[model samples]
Target: MITANPAPEAGTEARTGSSPVRAVTRRKKRQWLPYLLLLPVVVAELLIHIIPMLIGVGMSFLELTQFYIRNWTAAPAAGVGNYRFVLQFDEASGKALLHSFWTTVQFTVIVLALSWLLAMAAAIWTQHAFRGRGLVRTVFLVPYALPVFASVITWSFMLQRDNGMVNHVLVDQLGVTDERPFWLIGDNSFWALIVVEVWRLWPFAFLALTAGMSSIPAEQYEAAAIDGAGVLRSVRWVTLPNLRSVNQVLLLVLFLWTFNEFTVPYTFFGKSAPEQADLISMHIYQNSFVTWNFGTGSAMSVLLLLFLLAVTAVYLLLTRKKDVDA
Candidate 1:
């Protein structure tokens, strides 16, 4: 016959059961710790970005102008009047806004194309280890690392019509043209803006692309090589496919930054950008500050915010779907 087992002590059973409970408690504490640390950042973001954006959205519905500048809250409400006026298209203000929108679209497209192409080329070139590679990479980053204000100001001075380095080089040294061209004025200003923007932005793109490339496995490239894939072929089949995630992020960020660019245009053309180069940022600024029409400006800003949000959402959705499918 088998002997009966002894019953476990209550204290022993309680201690064994409590162990898991204690572990779970500790795990919860661990999970909450990071959030506790992030509390300050969350608060700061709410204060700095969210609050002001809400206030601006509110201001969009108001008849706030220079008359009520001293007391914005006391301004009369317009109740969507500002939005209606901006979207009327037939009106002068609407026409100006539409023109600026198209200008910004063109500017953003060219910048994205040029910046990505240059960045991609540079990254691919640097992918193969070679002499002076470090120096070349450093040179590429110089434009990105330079102070925006100082660099843009220098560009402004260099772009001067007379007695400028650009003109000097073209007319005196290279003799590309008989007369000095007005780089900071007329249609040339648009091209000048593009050159400066591409020069400034491509380095950052190169940095991002290089980082993406580093994460790609060398064996994959070797395998491609064994399959008779050359440089272009490897990039098409392996490099780009691997870097799809990086390109998605890079292109979206570049698009947003280029679209909202203010400093380059402001520094290049002062308060008034030429009509051809009148980007939406300067347009909004002129409407808000120069005309002292804060209500209209706020409306335009809200529209822009909505547009960017929509674009970002759509892009993320499409990219996520592609990722899932792959």
Candidate 2:
């Protein structure tokens, strides 16, 4: 069946003016590959993150019931109700907003200050002629290596009311106290949280500062030394100033973490519920979980988010956003 043999395939295509499948394939690849590669991430983000956030935004302005059955079916708009309620929110929330704000502030400031101070000291120490400086630096990382939950438990045990290591050391071992210190008592819990918090997070600061110190160009410090800049002068003029961005970013991030952190305090002081230690996060839990007031609880969450956003924005603007690196 010599039926025109369809010419040769390429020749037939050329003659008949049909585009080859390879061209179609290449065209598809050129037109769609990038987007196809991007599709998974876009889909994942929409499903996992974007949808939840939109739901939260919608819920923040709604009065949906527990099961979200749409009791009124009006799309549940609260307009500025949730926001206004939060701005004037007081009665049930107690001093929770204030307490959480201040405690978070206290925790963040101490962690930042102590972390940088200790880190800087250790960094400077390492730069000197010390035996086993590497080992010492490695040892300093033990606390940081402990997971948060384990660390919190360890600290709690140490700070417990009786037989705690801190009390044992300060009283029996050192003769510093007549009796065991009540570290977790209502009166002392706030400060106790602070102490443990600082201890647990200090290693982070130490590591960062140490790395920063090591990264400092040796030539710059050598020049400073040649100009008669002493240790303190070099740190103040060169080291600290150079660390500005890293420090700022760490401070803000740590503050946010502390602000929203719930587990440690919840585990340590729950049932006992220290008034001073009741941070906004805990308050949110109480309202949302304990009291099952989802509306008010969601309101609290929205408020806390707004507060953190504003605070972070203001801080960035004042310290970082406005500064030119020059």
Superposed Cα deviation of residue 240, candidate 1 (Å):
1.0
Give model 2's TM-score versus the native structure.
0.79
Tell me the tens digit of each residue's lDDT in model 1 across 107-223. 999999999999999999999899999999999989999998889889989999887889999999999999889988889999999999999999999999999999999999999
Reference-based lDDT, residue 233, model 2: 90
All models: lDDT?
Answer: 0.91, 0.70
**lDDT: worst 10-residue window of model 1:** 1-10
Q: What's each prediction's TM-score?
A: 0.89, 0.79
> What is model 1's C-alpha RMSD?
10.0
Clashing pairs in 2: none
